[model samples]
Target: MRMAAGTEDRERGADLAEAAPIIRANGLSVYYGTKQVLSDVTLDFPSNKVTAIIGPSGCGKSTLLRCFNRMNDLIPNFNMTGQILFDGVDLYGPGVDSTEIRYQVGMVFQRPNPFPKSIFDNVAFGPKINGYEGKLDELVEQSLRRAALWEEVKDRLKSSALALSGGQQQRLCIARALAVHPRVILMDEPCSALDPFATLAIEELMRELSEDYSIIIVTHNMQQAARASDYTAFLMGNEERIGELIEFGETRQITTNPEDERTEAYITGRFG
Candidate 1:
């Protein structure tokens, strides 16, 4: 028998509350020059779970994701207020190394961006630069297996990564991220460039990966967010509020019975 929606939501909330969040954002506001992109956003990301950020175009979902690993620092005139905590440490605090932070938090972009080098080289690049002392080949194989690409590309490891299909290249990118042993993986519209079949494959891989790594994805597809994530955050912004988190909760709760009317409207096709 199924529980009532309220009861289910309460139980899930309690369970999540008990787990220490792997990442936390408090009063996180970002800006590029004088334009504010995000404002006073505070949220907790549960450990070892998939969290999806859904919003309309130009809502700063990608910007928020980039902040977690300090990717926004590369952009000129990028400035942010407030704190993002990883494992209880402030990411923007003084004396922190952004390069080390990036290694611990990997990212995969929207397009399947594979290197011009061979598949083996692509996976080994991160570890090689970081001065890995262990067996390089084993690490490459393990990362590929974790990303569910080893079986398909095992026989052709020497082939150029550009030679793989779109889906395979994305998986290769995922493998490259995993090669560095990141605790969290950030995906920015990972399936927007793929066909339905390839999209499904990526979703399946996400589910499996969530058992070992915290996965945060930004997707425009509502169905993909509902199907692939354990928790969902709905963001909306206007001329006044650039990117504010409207509602955040379990996937079922947020998708089925959102407490905010704005969330209901966006999810039900009433308005963006």
Candidate 2:
């Protein structure tokens, strides 16, 4: 009993709810002063999986990513009202500690930003601040290994972080985040600044990391999302254009066939 080639995508997508979603959002919205960027958006991120947020430029994808770890709070005039629940705990609740939230949910930005210190210091910074009492050398080694940069930088542990290439520096950043022992990792266009080989390496690292950590990435490259992500969420450009969640579902389904016309258009080269 084979389905037709062009059947309804919504029908196929509805069949993918077997797993429970770990992070849930309800009626999420964001505003920058008088400007309303995101509208009401609700979605779920399944545990231990990679969820990619893909859309045209200015989509609420990055903005939504910030909400997970409260990165938005750093922006002046950034205000949002929503429920971002992590393991059933509302991250924005009155008692929720922003510092703890960041420790549990780490972030990696687009560019490779490393401190002007030794490579070891860059990885150990978070743990030292968190009062990690374990063996510092072991922790530094493990975090670097997890980032897949250990094999490349083991001999130069004491070398300046800036001595490494662009790609290595980015991995060091990832290790720094890992040193804090986060449960979820939020990546904002992590590979945009890397070369083709480096991008592939990062994608592979992401897949590997998902075995133990949940990952949410905001990326413009639809192909990367299709290739690396387990779930996909599509967002539209923001207001002035009013960014909003367009559609979300399984990665294969979203790329090969999407529920919304806009998602299909963006994936099929019809539009970004």
Candidate 3:
């Protein structure tokens, strides 16, 4: 399919698992009651690649991210028009289960939101609720290890998650998402709340995780996006507060040589 004039084609890259996109948004627009948040935005998230959504505040970055997993449906008066395809299947089509979509497409929020339960229980919660019959102990350990937090809290599995540091809590949240064995992971500013060192840790973890899972992240940090992502989508909000996709392409190109003047302006710190 031919992309719009300003949109970039899916570039061949070593980080992408396949040329075909795992998630495709066709003319996607989102509204909250009478207020339109995102207008006719279309983009693709390639398999096994880190796609960063960057823009100024209120540009619908998070709203578009939430649409992938139907997380926006939780908000009252939220609605949208467009087709979000996951592996050629329309996520909003008839008979599509939002719960099942969330299972396959997990999310990690800007803040670490671990349950008040123990560390082990936080990782085990998803599988338990899904009626997983596998060895829960093994699953917990595997998830924590994948999130690169097992060694830190391995001996304290029974300890409260709230007791861990902020960075640890965020990794625990990622581990919780991984516990469900999701095919895609949606992260909304996963490192926003962390210190520089913690943020770098999360970035490193994202690079490692992208080897196995397709990742879409919404971030305000230009450096983080350039350093961690394989592809980038730039969104901008107008005076009416409706967000539009200004540019989309490989991270290096988007960062170093953007096609759109607005994208270049934003990336070069002229405006946000």
Whose lDDT is greatest here?
3
Candidate 3 structure quality by residue, lDDT tens digits, 1-272: 53434543445333343467889999999999989999998877898999999999999999999999999989999999988999889999999999999999999999999999999999999999999999999999999999999999999999999999999999999999999999999999999999999899999999999999999999999999999999999999988879998888789988878889999999999997
Scored by Cα lDDT, where does model 2 land?
A: 0.86
Worst 10 residues of 3 by lDDT: 8-17
Candidates arranged by TM-score, highest first: 3, 1, 2
Deviation from native of the Cα of residue 16 in model 3, angstroms:
7.6
lDDT string for model 2 (1-272, tens) is 11112332456435544445667777788988888888877777888899999888877788899999988899989988778898889999998999999999999999989999999999999999889999999999999999999999999899999999888998999999999999999999999999988998999999999998999999988889988999888888744687877787779888777867878988888986
TM-score of each: 0.95, 0.93, 0.95
Off by over 4 Å in 3: 8-18
lDDT of 1 by residue, 1-272 (tens): 11122233555667677768888888889999999999888888888999999888788899999999999999999999989999899999999999999999999999999889999999999999999999999999999999999999999999999999999999999999999999999999999999999999999999999999999999999999999999988888967769988888888888889888878998888887
True-structure RMSD for candidate 2: 4.1
lDDT of each: 0.91, 0.86, 0.91
In TM-score terms, candidate 2 sits at 0.93
- Model 2, residue 195: distance off in Å is 0.4
